[model samples]
Target: PYHSVAACAGLLRAGGFTELADGAQWKLARGGKYFVSKGGSEIMAFIVGGRFCQPGVESGLSIVGAHTDSPCLRLRPNSKVSGAGMLQVGIQTYGGGLWHTWFDRPLGLAGKVVVREAAPGRPDETRLAEKLVRITDPLMILPNLAIHLQSAEERKAFAVNPETHLQPVLCSKMFDDEAGKEASRPEDAGDARHHAALLEVVAKRLGCAPGDIMDADLCLMDSMPACLAGLYEEFISSPRIDNLLSTWAAVQGLCDFAASSAVADCQDVCIAVSFDHEECGSQSTCGADSNSMSVWLESLLGALEVPPLARPLVYAKSFLLSADCAHGVHPNYAAKHQSEHRPDFHKGIVIKTNANQRYATTALTSALFREVCKKADVPVQDFVVRNDSPCGTTIGPIVSSKLGIRTIDIGAPQWAMHSCRETCASSDARHLRALCGAFFESFRNIDTAAAKM
Candidate 1:
C-alpha cells in the first residue's frame, strides 16, 4: 500500500460506496453502491442499476479503467550501501523512467512495510502486519555529477546508468550512533542490511519499533507538490500526471454521475477500476491482466441471481473506456508525433488508435465515445502513432481481449511522460471527467441504438 491507496479508499467511502471483501459471499442489493479489491493498490467501485435488477431484464457494464502506478525508483532489500562515511540506499528502476530527470532532485521514501509480530509458541512463525511509511521531508537526494566531470557527449545530453548512478544518499555515518540508539533493532542477521537512519525515520513515522519492521516495499517519490504553471496558470506541472489524472477523472466522473439526476435513468452498471502494475506488464494479481474483473463480474451477476445462460449476454453488452494518458505534441519535439494526428492539450480527451492493435479502439467504440463527448459538450481529439514510431499500449487491449467487451482507448493530453515530473493542460482533466460522466449516463442507450443498425 502507498499514500494514494489510502486516499483512494477515503474518497470512495466519502462518495457513499460500500466496500465488499473479495473472498466473502456478496450480498448486493439493487441500486447498491459497492467497491472491492484484495490489495491496497487496487480499487474497483460499481453502482448496480435499479432498472437492470428487474426480473428477466438484460443489462451491461459501463466501465472506466485506469491505472494507479507510475514510473519511479523502488528500494531493494538489503538496500544499505555505504562508503566514505556517507550512506546510500540501493534502488532498482521500477519502470521506464527518464533516468536523467531524477538526478539532483529531492526525494521521499513512501510505501508499505511488513511488520512482524512474534508468535507466542513458535519462534519461526510470525504474524505479519503492513504499515504504510513515508519519509517525505527530503531526507534523501540523488545528486547529479558536476557538469565539469561530464564528457562532451554527456554534456550535450545527460545519460545515467541505473546501477551506479541512481542510488539516493540517505545520511552521513555521524547519525549511526544517535539514530541507531533511538531505533532499537533486533539482533537478527538481516537487520544489519538496513541503514539505522532510514529505519529510524520509518519507525518514527509509524510509531513502531524499528526491529518490528521485517521487510518493506519502499520507493523513492518526488517531493514536489503539483502546481499551476504557464501564463495565467493554464498548465498543471506535476508528477504522475499521466495515469493519476485519468484515475481521478474516472472516479470524479462516477461520483458526479451518481449525484446527478440522470443516474436514476442509467440502465447499465457503472464502474471505475484503478489497477496497479500497469507501468510494468500488468501481470500481478491486482493488475488488469489478472482475472480480477472477470471474477468479480461473474460474482456480481451470480449474487444478483442472473441466469447462468444469460451471463454471456451481459458481457456482450458491456463496454470499457480504457483511460490512460496521451502524448501531447511537445513544442521542442513536435516532429516525434504524427503530423496530422498529434493531440493537443486542453482540446479535450484523445482517442488513441494503432493499426497493430496496441490500443483496443474500433470504429464502433470511437463513434459511441464521440457521441458521449458531444452530449457532454466536451471537445474531443485523436491520436495516432507515426508510421516509423513504436506505439505504447494500455490495459484496453488486455481487458477487452479477456472479457470481449467493446473497448476504446482514451486519455487527457500530457507531456514528458515517465519523467520525474510532467505537465498537462488544466482544462483537459475537467473535459475527461465530463466525458466519463456522459459515457456512464448514455452508453447503454447509445449501444442499444448501434445494435439496432
Candidate 2:
C-alpha cells in the first residue's frame, strides 16, 4: 500500500532529508545530509552521509541491503472468469508461494494504479503514485474439494491447480442473473458490464475516472492484522515477517548509527537499502541487481567530488551487510536441517553461507562481521544449506558483484517465511537490531589498511 511507502518515506524525511519526486521516482535527501528512495518497491535504498568526512576526503560508504517485496498471488490483467454461474477473479502464483495456504481465507486487494493525472503540456508524461484498494468484506473464498469429491487416496495425494483450485468467488454479483440479464450484452453487457460496475464502485472510492486508470499491479493480502501471538506472548506473529523482521532491524540500525555518528568525526558514509521483488527475483529496477543503489552512490560520490581512482579504494575497504530472514529449524521438520547447522529462535544473528556462492558470505566476510559483533558484544550464529536441499539466495551476492564490496549475509530465525501470517521470536527481532547497529557503527571504525588485507 501507499501508506506503507509513506510511512517509510516519513522516517527518511524525519531523519533530516528533503524529498524529491522525479516522475515515478521518489527520492528523499537531506540538504548535504541523508538520502532515501523508493524505486517503486522493485527496490528501495537510502544513503546516510554528509557529515563526519575529512576535509578534501569523501566519506567511505558502509551499506546494508534487503528486499521489500514478498511472495503472493498476483491478479492477472484479464483476471475475470465465470464458474458455476458465479464470477471469479483469475490469478496466478507470483512466486514460490505455498498454494494451499491461500485457500479459504479472507483476502484484500491493494496496489498501485498507473493513472492519467492532470498535467500541463505533456499529457503523455502522466504522474504516478500508489493507489491502494481493499475489499474489506469477505467477498471471496477458495473452497477446497470436499472429502466426498476426493477419494481417501485422492485427498491425501492431491496437488492444487492454480487455474481451478485458486479461483476466488466474487460474491452475490456472480449469481445475480436478473442484474446480469440487464447487463448481459458484450457490446452492451456481460463480464465487461460487471467489471465496469465494480470499477464504478472502486472509482467512487478512489475519486477518479475508470478510464483514467491505465494498468495495475494488484496484490491479494490476508485481511489479518499483525499481532503478538504464542502461549506466553513472547513472539511476533505477523504477515511478511520473513524479511520485514530484518527490514525493521536494518532501519533501526541506520537510525541508531546516524544518531551515534552525530558527534563523531569519521570519514565514512552509511546506507540502508530495502529492495523489492527479492521473493521472486532481483531483476527489477528496484531490485539489488538493478542500478538504483549504484546510481545513488555514484551521485553522492560525485557530489562529494571523490576521484575515480580512489573509488575502488573505498569499495575495497567497504562492507555491505545483506539483511534477510533465515530459516529457524522447525520442530516438526527438524530433519530438514543439519543438527549443528540449525539456528534457534532468539539465539543470535545467523550468518548464511553457501559453498556454491549462492550467499555472499565468505570466510573473510564472516571474519570481519565476527570482529564487529565481538567488539559490540553481540552473539552470532552460522547457517549452511543442507547439502541435498536447495538454498534460497539473497541480495548479498548481487550487491557484492555489482559494487565489488565485501558482503556478508545475516538474518533472524523465523517460521513460515512465505506464509500470509509468519512468525518470529520477539527476542530475535531485538537481537538482530543490536547486531545490525553494531555492524553499522563498527564498520566506520575498522582500519582500512587491516580491512583490505
Q: Which candidate has the highest lDDT of all? A: 1
Cα lDDT of model 1 by residue, 1-453, tens digit? 356667766788898989899877899877778888767788888888878746655589999999988999998888989766778898989879997898888998889888877677889888988778877688889888888998999988776789988888888777765656424655554556787678868988988777777898888888877899997999999988978898888888888777877766667889998889998999999899999888998888889898899878888889999999999999899999999988988788899999899999999889999988888899989999999988999999999999999999999999999999999998998898888888888888777877644
Score each candidate by Cα lDDT: 0.86, 0.70
Best by TM-score: 1
How many clashing pairs in candidate 1? 0
In the predicted model 2, the residue pairs found to clash are 18-29, 42-286, 43-286, 68-275, 79-90, 185-189
**Candidate 1 structure lDDT:** 0.86
List model 2 lDDT by residue over 1-453, tens digit each: 233455556666676545544233433233234545654563243444544345665456677777667777777887756677766777878777777887778877766666557666777676654565655555557767778988888888778887778877665554455566325435633234235544544565678876556666777777777888888988898777867677667766766666664424546676667877777777886677788778777766655666788777777667888999989889999999977899988788899999888999988788888888787777788899888999999989988999998889998888887876788888888888887777766666554435454
lDDT of 2 at 342: 92
